[model samples]
Target: MFNESKKAMTAISQYCGNRVDYVQGGGGNTSYKFNDKLMAIKASGYTLADVQPEQGYVTVDYSKISRKYDEISKKMDIDVEAETLLINLDCVELLHGMKDLRPSVEVGFHSYLQKAVIHTHSVYSNLLCCSDEGRDNAKSIFENSKYGYIYIPFISPGYTLSIRVKDEVIAYKAENGKMPDLIFMESHGMIASNDDYETAIEIHETANQMMIDYFNSVEFPKAIIKKTSKGFSSKTEMINKFIVDFSADENYFDTVNIYPDQIVYLQNNLGKTILIDKDNASIEYIMSEKQAQTLEEVLLGVVYIITEIKRNELSLKLLCKEGEDFIRNWESEKYRASLVND
Candidate 1:
């Protein structure tokens, strides 16, 4: 069972992992359900590109997780995060022997989805999802497409997010007679789930392209990062221009933030990764090459989303203060960031 899932995880990771625009750092989770009882998902703090056919994922009793969601839904005043984490821990298949690994915090929602699920914090999706009219624009963008779509407003990640998504998915299935293939979460990102790996990838690609075409948006500008003795520096025209313009504003990144990954990778740590020398109009990274690269991608992505949103005259939909705080304190996100920053 793990064999088939491992193959599928590797395939999907190879397909999207290295695409910086699709995911930066360890910001995405991919999963494959081997059957009704067991499913394999990416481990916490690991980048998709880091996944191989034989490693980088863990198998869990998804059926148990799905059942637990149903049980929790009936109860009142439950500690959603604590309850969900314990449930996921209990459902882990110890026989497989990845004991130290933790399933993605999103396991609850994945358990109820199709066999193959790819969730990405894609910049293309954020162009629409990070705008005030995101849901309405999404409806019009994918309106005539073959895939069924659902929109979830911004919410807390982990158990709270998963439960909300579960409700929406269940309601969608009831009315449409099938689960939705495309899910667009406001101030979050997009999810493409299907019965197989190829179709899931297809749905994700097609939907992102649809959003791109809808906005008549150009491709993101190249992020030119050059290594230096101290670390790395940004040479891209767009990025340097952004730095020159917004360097004076200390909270600029937080203001332009369009999604959770922006918070996790940029805003929270501030100048730890990329150092902005406002006096000289220079930006330098003081972290590892991989961490520097991740910061560069995220920095450029945030700038790109802001540019496109402003060009289209759509009101920016920044992550709320509550949302920002939640992500700031999330243990799972901290672990993921630690891996990149280490």
Candidate 2:
């Protein structure tokens, strides 16, 4: 089963990497468990398409980590002491030895799953997660689906997310007498699994298609842009403010650039409603075709914005449903290598 599962992992990785809507660059991870003793997972910083059975895949001993943590905690009297002991336990050494690769931050979540786990940052899933309305829309789509779906709110990756997933899975099993077939992370993506490789892959693909179908059914309101030079500076300022508020990262600062689409979007509708006082001199307008196009793409697209702050790489990604325009956009097609140069 282990060897077969390894092959399945490689196949799934390739499938995900090949589909830009499913994964881009190093955005997703996959795993398979042979038994209580060993599990293989995709390595960090590697695309699924290039992963070979022996290269990007890593095998680690799960029993060792679990046993070591359990043993150390039982011997410790204080919770603080137990946590400190667990962090420094030899289990860390064992993890480090697993191809010297950093395991997925969601490793704990995978450990609790069955023989195989496929975590993908699919565009459709992200689109559904980003908006409050989108979440409800997704729930409605899967209301009567055969596969169990669980939605978990966004949490920063690492131990916090891993522990939350573990607890949620446990709670779900206790309540329903079964584990969910898929876990949807709000503002993130999804984790899916099954005993059979084909079944797991099918579930993921079908679920994504369902969401895409739902998104396509939505009638987007047309954006009407109004031209005004006085409003441009003010609109840019407002956009900058919105970006800062949304990200709350100092690194963004004044470096945020409002492209032509954004300018058109703001000058059209927002400029009318928002008052332009001295302190709030920013002009507002409605959405523009370009902005609408961009927003539509963002809702249905997989975008990764790589920024450099003080020479360090800062990549901000928005994984959402790919809009029709985006799919047909020459620039986007080129980026995905879906179009050939003449």
Each model's lDDT: 0.82, 0.52
Clashing pairs in 1: none
TM-score, cand. 1 = 0.92
* lDDT, model 1: 0.82
Candidate 1, 93-150: lDDT as tens digits: 8434454578888888888789999999888888878999888898888878898999
What's every prediction's RMSD, in angstroms? 2.1, 14.0
Q: Write the per-residue lDDT of candidate 2 for residues 169-256, one digit (tens) a residue.
A: 8898898898788888865678888877778888888888787576552322222234454322223332334444345222222123
Clashes of 2: 14
Which runs in model 2 stand beyond 4 Å of their true positions?
65-99, 217-342
Model 2 worst lDDT window (10 residues): 302-311
